[model samples]
Target: MNHGPDDLSSTGEFDSDELALRRMLQQAVQEMEPRDGTLDHLRKAVPARRARKRQAVVGMAAAALFFGTAIPAVVHVSSTGTSANTSNAGHASQTQGGAGQGKEEEGGESTSGGSAGKPEDKGKGESKDADKGKSAGASTGASSGTDPSTSTAASAAVCTAVQLGTPTATTAVPDASGTVYGTFHITNGSTAACTVSGPGIVTPAAQGAADASKISALRHVSGDVASAGLPDPSQEVAQLLLQPGSSYDVKFAWVPTETCPTSEPSTDPSPDPTTSPDASSSEGSSTGGDTGTSTQLLTEDGTTDGSVLVTNTAEGGGPSVSTTVSNACAGVVYWTGLLTSS
Candidate 1:
């Protein structure tokens, strides 16, 4: 049935030229690269991306709804359930019981609302304070400021009159200027050490009432006791440290002179006592005039009838003590200095 190419074309059948072109096209398509699974991957990825976006939108809406509605509901439940309400006593009790048990399971802390929780709250507060105390005690050494234990130890180490003993006096010969010098010795009789201060008084010895004496010295008292602390700008006082069975001396100097220094009289007018209340109140009051009395070495009555009183500076008030000495010289000027040990 082999027919010519022109006759097949005229009979409206497949031409030779069209057949060759189809064969060439098929061969070219087969030689090209094939894409495996690319379309399938794209088809899978588009729907997955759309699903994730939709899920995100749904999650945002759910979160907004929970915050706007469910959160307030939970808050109302927590507040109404845990707190007191006079209208609903039974409900409050039940809620309180549940809250207490729940709190115990959480951290052993009962809400401070009803009487049932008060005891637990008190015990927990006490436990917390005890823990704080232990931590504070552990860090005490590193803390700044005053500590009670340190202050107590320091006070215990300070010396006082409880350890001081009786003082004895001895006289020496008069110098070329007729000034009398003497030494008084104080011994520590206690089992511990002590501190003693001086510039103490020295006057004529006495017993009960003052009476005339035959001694040829003036009745004069020395200045105040030399302080064991910093007192003034011009003078420095050092206290005597007396150990057990130890002693220290205080030197005394007396000048038998006649002249005495006096304060000049003030020219201001005196105040009137008639305008005041009573006479007894005006006894020691100065009237803005020259009312200061003169100080003399000799007593007015010329008697040595007073008792000696020795006052010691100490806490808790120690033992009672006295020193007796007589000075009968007339018109004598006396001066005392800081205490010293030689």
Candidate 2:
């Protein structure tokens, strides 16, 4: 069992020489001393080194997280923009297509048939344009049709003598100037409508003491002092369409002059003395006194002295209507145009 040093080495046991060498290393380690300040330097260097390592790790993680979120966000934004552009393009195409369809319907042509230079297409286009023009013209004509109707109503046939009712006359109290103002009322007796134009012919009645020469001196005026307190005839219409049973007024002024003749006494023989006194007095009163000439008298009833006659001759001829416009002195007559009744 006792082996040599070579036998002990093969058996993994330390010999006397190895034991002595280990003892020498231990002795050297026990006697060794660090340089001054070496511990403090190591203490500070260790924590700083650890902090640098941690900062490097955190920086790497943050860079990774930022890149991860940023790349996807960029991709999403790019995709969204692309989608919006595509949608806008689609909508634009649809709008254009609809417009094309409308044009096709109106012009009776297809968008695919781009042969605009063909004779048949040109003819169709011209025909459509002509139809549009015709429609516009028809609309315009329909809108303008009201004026003719109004003009027709205004231009009714002239009233005839048979269609007119018997005209009546009225006279107002004479003014201080012996100017008599009155009105002539003309009516439409027939059922039909008719027109009366202009101030009709006016003449004095033959029954009164109206002088023919004086009556012939009638004048037409817009207005005069004799027409005061009455409606102004200047503003009245010259012509009027009268419906059945309707009436119109014509104002007249009888202005007297100083040339009228005075009354003259009758030359008849005096009544017999045997006649009763009352009868004689009546007869004498009936005849004017044989004395100086007296001024002509005009009464309200027109039987006293003078008279006037009015005839509507607008239709060539009509019945003569007479009104009492007795003027004491010889004067001119003024008549007015047609005036609507109040």
Candidate 3:
């Protein structure tokens, strides 16, 4: 039984074969170890691979940007050319429709897609022209509606003297110098329009005169007359035409208590009233018949009577109107005599 369990008939021979197998395994393990530069080569290869991937990604982005820019540019250019051709075609169609044939002669396509859009463009153009014409007509109508000269003439027509009422005198409180201002207002009372012009006449009616002839004789050549004032009635002024119920105003002034200044002889040779024949005769007659009766009129309160008669002359051969104003004396207006006018 012991021979059966450890029965190595050639035990020394098997031992030599085991030593050879162990030597072969040791040599194979040493051959299988990594080389010195293997990890360094792997690190270098990883960076190279990452750099290539980045380059590929950058190239793809650049291509996308190029295509994005180029596509819209191409579309814009194509659309611009199409619009130009369409406009030309429209113009030609309106005239003779021969531009397409000419373009075809120049190596251009006659059946282009832009040809279909020409009808719509022409419709738009016609609508625009119609709108322009409408606008022009509206502007012309607006201008014609309000003509300046016609409006001015219509507004300037005024009432004449034939339509006016008699001038009425109004007296205000006297000033410090015993001077009173008399304002005469003339109103247009008739239905007819009229114009009043000129420096009207004012005659002071002598109060308590025995006869009208004596009152006329009291009026002297050097008395109240028409004179230019603020508006300078002497200048060519536009006629003030008044409508119905319109009115105009004129001013008359006086100083009832003021005395005439005493006359003094000057260095210049002047005629003496006492030596004159007419003055001597007038003084002798006044002393004989009219001794107590004063030549110059005086009011009841001993002040000089300042009564006046105003006459308004009409324009263009129209009838004149007269008014009698009581208590209006002569006044200085702009270094001349102040009469009646507006």
Candidate 4:
């Protein structure tokens, strides 16, 4: 039989036996189809994944058959694949629904794999899946959650802190105001302290000084001056020493009072021709300082010694003063007056 290409068979087309088998298969398929509420339940429970795949396979099979490209073996496989895909989709949907709604309503329920693992492990997996959008099965180890990343960051921070130590403090201060800050580590053998004050080890910044209080403050900041004399705060000194092992600190900050300025010098001679009674005084002979020339002086003993008088006997009775002719030499500091307006 020499037929057209589309109609030609290998002289062994569908025999009676083959045709009967096909008819039986078609009847069985029709009988096995979902009935009553079964089709509705399956549609509600089936997921889009396998259902969509089933539809694709069936469409491909229909197109191939219409074009007369049917191969019996290929058709059998295609139909089987569609049925398996639809069944798997229904099962997947049911699992998803049970995990959530406990019941499949109009739409199928979703699942994060309930029966797939232990309840505890499944819960953790679901949580990770929700956060990362990854497969629940991927959440098996500690690295599954974002917490691992945070933990790594925290560890890095702690290591950095341990290596870098503490931050330094800085501040600016004026002449009268100053910032105080320092740090030192203590060890068993290191008991002595290197004392300092006002920025130097033993010296302090210079400022105006008044009474003992200000001086004491300076000493406190200056870390005690070095000296060999008595350690009396009452005495005046430039520097002092400190005891070992113990630290001392101090500061010298104060403003001084202003003194009057000296005027022009006079042309008058000192020790001028005063009382011609310069010969000698009768013991207790009504004697007193010539108020016109001599000036008053307070002594160390806090008493006024009229014997050691001074006079401003300048040429024009202007700015200068001089002491009397007694105790001229001996290492004593005598005070001379300079003329000042009252």
Which one is best on TM-score? 2
- Residues 160-246, candidate 2: write the lDDT tens digits: 888876887787887776777777787778877777775577654432455666554445544555456456655677576677777
Per-residue error for 7 in candidate 1, Å, reads 81
**TM-score of each model, paired residue for residue:** 0.27, 0.44, 0.33, 0.15
List clashing residue pairs in candidate 2.
203-309, 204-308
Residue-level error in angstroms, candidate 3, position 86: 17
| Superposition error at 262 for model 4 (Å) | 64
Best by lDDT: 2
Candidate 1: stretches off by over 4 Å: 1-162, 197-199, 203-236, 258-327, 333-335
Candidate 1's TM-score: 0.27
| Candidate 3 vs 4: which has more lDDT | 3
lDDT of 3 at 329: 43
lDDT per residue for candidate 3 within 248-327, as digits (tens), equals 55554443432322223336655576587987657644534745654554455555544445443433443444444354
Q: Count clashes in each candidate, considering only residues at least 3 apart in sequence or on different chains.
A: 8, 2, 8, 17
State in Å the error of residue 235, model 3: 21
User: Best to worst by TM-score, what's the order?
Assistant: 2, 3, 1, 4
Q: What range of 10 consecutive residues in model 4 has the weakest lDDT sum?
A: 333-342
Tens digits of per-residue lDDT for model 1, 1-342: 866545667787787788677668878897787589989999999999999999999999999988999888998988887664543765565465554454542445555445454545677899999999998886544322222212112212444555655656655555565555555555667776444444344443323332224222322233422121112223314444445666554444444342222334447676576646666455535444484532232344444223222222222243333333333233232333334344
* Candidates 2 and 4 compared by lDDT, better number: 2
